[model samples]
Target: MEMSLQSMQLQLQFFMHKADDLHSCLVNGQGHVERDALAAAVVSFLYTCQPYFNHLESTVRSTRPQHTSLALNIYTQLLDIYQQLCDKLEQLVLSCASYNLLCLEETEPNSVSHFCVGQCQLGQLKLTTFLYCKPTPYLSQVDTRLYKRMRWNVEKLQVGQKTDKDQGGESKEREAKTEYYFLCYEDIPNTHAETDWGRPGFSDGNVVRMWSIGQWVQVDPDPITETIDDWILCDVPQANYNKLLFLGIEEPSCCIATDYMQQLLLLWKSADSW
Candidate 1:
């Protein structure tokens, strides 16, 4: 146990230094930085560090009883460094256009590149296509059938809107408010697929259900008051009833939120575990 703790401490210190270096790079490379390369690097960093973060969290929890003070100190340090890295990544992602971060050569390039749509997990780093749907009273489980139907309907409506705008000219401008936002995974196999905007593989019938956010989720800035900030997925659904899907993005509007950062901080504080 002593050796394990010592190893964890070394790992944590290494990560802290890495985080500091990354933060400094982002701060220094403001105007002339290569946005795409930086975005890819940030994503790769998150993917690599996630497993270590998970292992450290589990270790801290399991060994707290035996090495209470030391374990807590390490965990606190971990949180501080992790949060700093996440904040830097988020800022970098939000500053550039979505297309700038596109990994075109990758087999499954992310729809929005560095914008993460779901919770982070060990060994999983793929960003998925997602739809912004009107909120229902209850959270509905989306199956393949429903998913296809919804996609078809949304696409048809969008086409119709385009036709109307083309013919009606300025007259249709009043009705041009977008009711939905759709980001699809690029370059799936299919000749008939709409590769320009939507996800691929619709013709093959091997549809991967996309993530959906309710319109009520406040993903965009409030048009009326303009005060509400955008929210990103912070935690996925967990076994505990109290630990439902969390939606929050950190401050400064550029920093990306980590999967467990906000939720874990809340849990640790509430339980007095840190």
Candidate 2:
């Protein structure tokens, strides 16, 4: 039996949401309550998705030329979602294993916890707190020489809105639309041809810069006079958004920006050059 593209997309969406929920549970430290059930759901979801992947691949290969592009696009989206699901599954499994190990250690008092002072101590997992810095003033007018070979651009758009639910009922209002500045850039490698240099294009092997909404804080307690002020770019988690809405991201969850921000913070905290 053949399934419609819409049906396949919907199915993928369902699976993506399931994976997201399971991942959230693990991250929130609630895995202990339903570790077995969560693991079982992940396994069942993987098995169910296998056939859809095969079918999508076959459809992309066998579809008519007129419909091939759409079919291929859907296939690509499904593949991306599947990859995220696999990543979530890996994390879930690791979390479960860690939980089991902790339980074992608790049950057996003879087991000695291996670690040194101030190194590798067991404690509650705490979520990192991020502060919103003020946006950069006249960002476009600023010189890009400090960024080296990289290029920058800013976009102001209404990514989403705020809704207020009153005591009477839900009051829908479009008057209060929050506009955000979406900062994006591409880091071009100097190894490229001189002719291709300064040209704005996203090609293979080029590192896509992070997207940021805000800029640097005006009053810096520890000001660095050496470095030029730049716009701050962050991801969904740092921005305090549930998901990536600005980029029209269809995925249920994204960690690229969050991961990038975390690494940048670590470098800034550890490096003295900043």
lDDT tens per residue, model 1, 1-274: 5576577667666766765665555555554356555656756765666666556544433333336786676666544544454454444444333334433211243632333222222211111212122111121332212111011011111113234556665332222222222212212234455654675434555333333322222322444444323223322211101212323221211112232233333564478643
- The sequence of per-residue lDDT tens digits that candidate 2 reaches over residues 1-274 is 1356667667767866776776676556454557666655545654565565555534433342345776566655544543454454445445544655222121245321111000010111111211111122223234331111111121212234445555544543333222222223224343443335566554556543333323333322223442333323211111211212232212112233323333443454467322
Clash pairs, candidate 1, are 90-254, 90-255, 90-256, 91-254, 91-255
TM-score for each predicted model, relative to the true structure: 0.32, 0.28
Deviation in angstroms for 111 in model 2? 24
Specify the highest-TM-score model's number. 1
Query: Which residue runs does candidate 1 get wrong by more than 4 Å?
Result: 1-6, 16-33, 65-274
Worst 10 residues of 2 by lDDT: 114-123
The lDDT per prediction is 0.37, 0.37
lDDT of 1 at 102: 35
List clash counts for every candidate, in order.
5, 1
What's the lDDT for candidate 1? 0.37
